[model samples]
Target: MIDEHRQDLAAEYALDALDPESARAFEAMLANDAELKALADDLRETAAALALDAPAHLPPPELRERILSRIRAEAEAGAPAAPTATAVAPSTEAPVPSGGGRNLLPWALAAGFAITTAALWMERGSLQQDRTALLQEARELRNRDFLAKVKIATLSAQVDAYSKATAVIVWDAEKQHGVVKLNNVPPAGAGKDYQLWVIDPKYPAPVNGGLVPVNAEGIARVSFSPDQPISKADKFAISLEPAGGVPKATGPIVLLGGN
Candidate 1:
């Protein structure tokens, strides 16, 4: 039987905070069970409530200004600007002549060599800093791509698992962007319906994305903008409830995905 613990797990999955192995285990169970499906719906509803009630966090004004300035500079330059921080230059040390030949050329060569070494050191430091920044940017891009693929795969799996109808939801991790696609879902009864939920991992609860209806083809797609990145969520789900959803899970889950 699906219990409150499962409901909680489903909620956590929607938020994207579940450890990898646990999420996979939950998905495995979700694949074959109807009761869990209902629980998933309830969790989704709870998530919707959390999304609506949660407070929003805005970036610091100074940080925003800095970002805007950087963007403007890039636009003016028609190219990307160098990173703000760079590596420190290496220290220079005079080298002694090979074989202790006290020759006039040795001292002259040493001075020239020291100057060249200093220049190279400075250049190396700048290059190192640039490399570090580039690496960080690359990592961020990769993470975003990974989350996108995960969302697509999770939705596809949910659709495949349902013997009845199913829906796919999408959200942007950074901007609270969102959309939904439905398949094979039947229309709800009068005074009964399905509602969407967007769960944030950082928050203690879920949030409402919107409501959706099953169509003639048993498919529906809804688009929305969330308050934050969907990728940071534990999971997304749908639920059958009264015409409107409740603040917490009060019914069974319709769909869910996480990790």
Candidate 2:
């Protein structure tokens, strides 16, 4: 029963749209249900990734009226309303042109065509922006990663399910600082988060590194350093943790690397 209720809240929780009470309740449930939590995390991650990948588009200004006028005019003529501008926002620019059911068809078709072209143009512009940003980010990451002196370890996804994902941990032992770059992992679902762990043999349990927030591409750059300096890191791993991260790992290990 609780799991059933949580299913409904999962997406909302991931989106942070749940009310405080609902969120707290969901978190409580997440603590005990590893399978449910893992599912939620995957869903949330995918949703986040999709949102980032999707382009935001606004319709051409005149597309709205051209559509509404045609519909209203059709009704006046006692004819069925024609299909409208599919991509347009609500029409606030102009009202239906006067003159009952007259020669508005041609103008409407032209306006619809113009709007479609304009939407494509806008989408192209958005895609260009995305490309520019991606290129710049890639350049910066390459320069910093390759040129800067650092220690790096390659991490492998733990299971076949995550074969597409990749991870690398870079650290400056002298500075006692590190960064984890995880790429191509599907986004964590709502109310679920990916977390990093530093496994030291001396310790009874793996020390929590922290929650990792990933982008739409499932790319996450997590900057972290352990609370206490260590002689050496035996290994590192990433797990699908509850949202905001748990004090200790209580979920499946998704990625792993040895020192």
Q: List lDDT for all candidates, in order.
A: 0.58, 0.67
Give the alpha carbon lDDT tens digit for every residue of 41-61 in model 1: 544543343344335443344
The digit string of per-residue lDDT tens for model 2 on 43-126 reads 455444433433555456665556556555654587457667467577778867656356588767875686667656656665
Error of 2 at 106 (Å): 75
Candidate achieving the largest lDDT: 2
lDDT of 1 at 56: 45
User: Which regions of candidate 1 deviate over 4 angstroms?
Assistant: 1-150, 153-162, 227-231
Q: Considering summed lDDT, which 10 consecutive residues are worst modelled in model 2?
A: 142-151
Per-residue error (Å), model 1, residue 53: 25
Angstrom error of the Cα, residue 24, model 2: value is: 56
- Model 1, residue 178: distance off in Å is 1.3
Give the distance in Å from residue 142's predicted Cα in candidate 2 to where it truly belongs. Answer: 17
